[model samples]
Target: MPITGTTRVFLIAGDPVAQVRAPEIYNHLFERHGIDAVLVPVKVPPARLADFVRNAFGAENVGGMWVTIPHKAAMMALMDRCDPVAQLAGAVNAVRRADDGAIEGALFDGIGFVKGLDHFGIPLEGRRVLVIGAGGGGQAVAAALALRGVGELAIYNRSTDRAADLCARLAAASGGVTKVAASPDPAGYDLIVNCTSQGLKQDDPLPFDPKRVDAGAAVEDIIMTREPTPLLKACAELGISAHAGFEMLVQQIPEYLRFFGMPELARTLQDDTSEVRALLYPK
Candidate 1:
């Protein structure tokens, strides 16, 4: 919708905000749905995050904000209330103000990832899954898969301690359903997800051997790139199905809208959003 003085604002805040495409995708949705809201990217450095949260989010017309990159975990400390999912994941990627004026938070990264896989006809129920990287995104995916009833989960990180910590946290939260990967080998798992930044650079090493990825297993890279990440390309060459990271971002749109109290946009968004999706794969 055209921004008026009364237009509600939603912010996607990160230090390096130029690379974020959330404003494009969400602003398109808002305009198409005729909602009087706008989503904008804000470059808020880590040190100033707490003050920004206190001042900006308290605005009467501010709907909510999406947190990204180094801010996801930090936002958790800033929220007055949190959804159970965010609590278990140890992070919050989005937040909205409550009726009582409290900032309520939710973690949607894993939810989006699972929905993206479902869109591709990949089911997690009873599947053995391996997630590489135990950072915020990795932890969120692991927690979501466990709650979705995946039969087994293996978490692997360069830091064994971080992976092990995520395992223990998930196991405790999910009643003993998660474990640290014995090895990074991915031979037999039904699903392997790369949640790390391994594929961002051309010379970046593969997180794991593509040969070890079974042809029967599906591989997903969580790095949003214009071209196929190295891991995805390797998986395709090996006859393993692969998916891009933005699949998760796209699939999470409805959830984010709902959290922002704009369920109307979720339903009214144009079915053909190819142009918007293309912008996500920036050159």
Candidate 2:
């Protein structure tokens, strides 16, 4: 299909839109599935986010926006309503205008992270997990991990207050099923996740000391990049299993389709994501 007036437009907004893999993934899906849609990246700084979103949505042909980086948490305030996860995480990765003209948002990062863990054959129930960073992605991953009935969930961030607040919200929502706390020590945790943007650039320190991570524990860096991040390199040197964020984004594809009003496409993807995975982690 050619880019024409009928092509529904989706914009991904971020300060640095160059690192995003959504357009490559979603556009491939649309083209392969014969859907007349296009996803493009748009760089919108923090100050102009509200204006950009409002004017972009005003266009009738604009389908939705994929929130990224600094925009996720801030986008929540612009939404008329958000799903429960978004409310809990105070962030959203996908947003769209409803038929009633109300702006709606949803967070898929947590579910996608958990599903990605399943894909990696990592156990969640009754296991100790440490999530570094209390930003939008961190909050979403922690919230989803709590729902998985983890034995203990520890949040580590530069700001103790932010991590403490996230723990409080999870406690209320999970009814204390999962023990949540604020800690920076990575020792003894079965699973450790790096949800910060630290690994995105050179000279950025690893979120946690890989040497301190317990034996048999797995580490995951949620920064999407084609190359191995410093954290992953450190993990490999220590002989520990470490994975990138590609799988997490891959798992979110179906959820994104469903959120964008393509239930059938979502179902088809849920049934078999092998092709998508292969595309992300090709030989």
**TM-score list, all predictions:** 0.92, 0.86
Count of backbone collisions in candidate 1: 1
Whole-model lDDT per candidate? 0.84, 0.87
lDDT of 2 by residue, 1-283 (tens): 6789899999999989988878888888888888899999999999999888988989988899999988998999999999888888889889999999998999999989999999999998888898898887799999888788787888888888888889888876665644444466689899999999998986798777899999899998999878899999999999999899988777898998899887887888888988788767778
lDDT of 1 by residue, 118-216 (tens): 889998888999999988779888878878878888999988999988888788666576888877789879999998999998678998998988767
Per-residue error (Å), model 1, residue 20: 2.0
Where in model 1 is the C-alpha error above 4 Å? Answer: 269-283
**Candidate 1 has which clashing residue pairs, if any?**
1-31
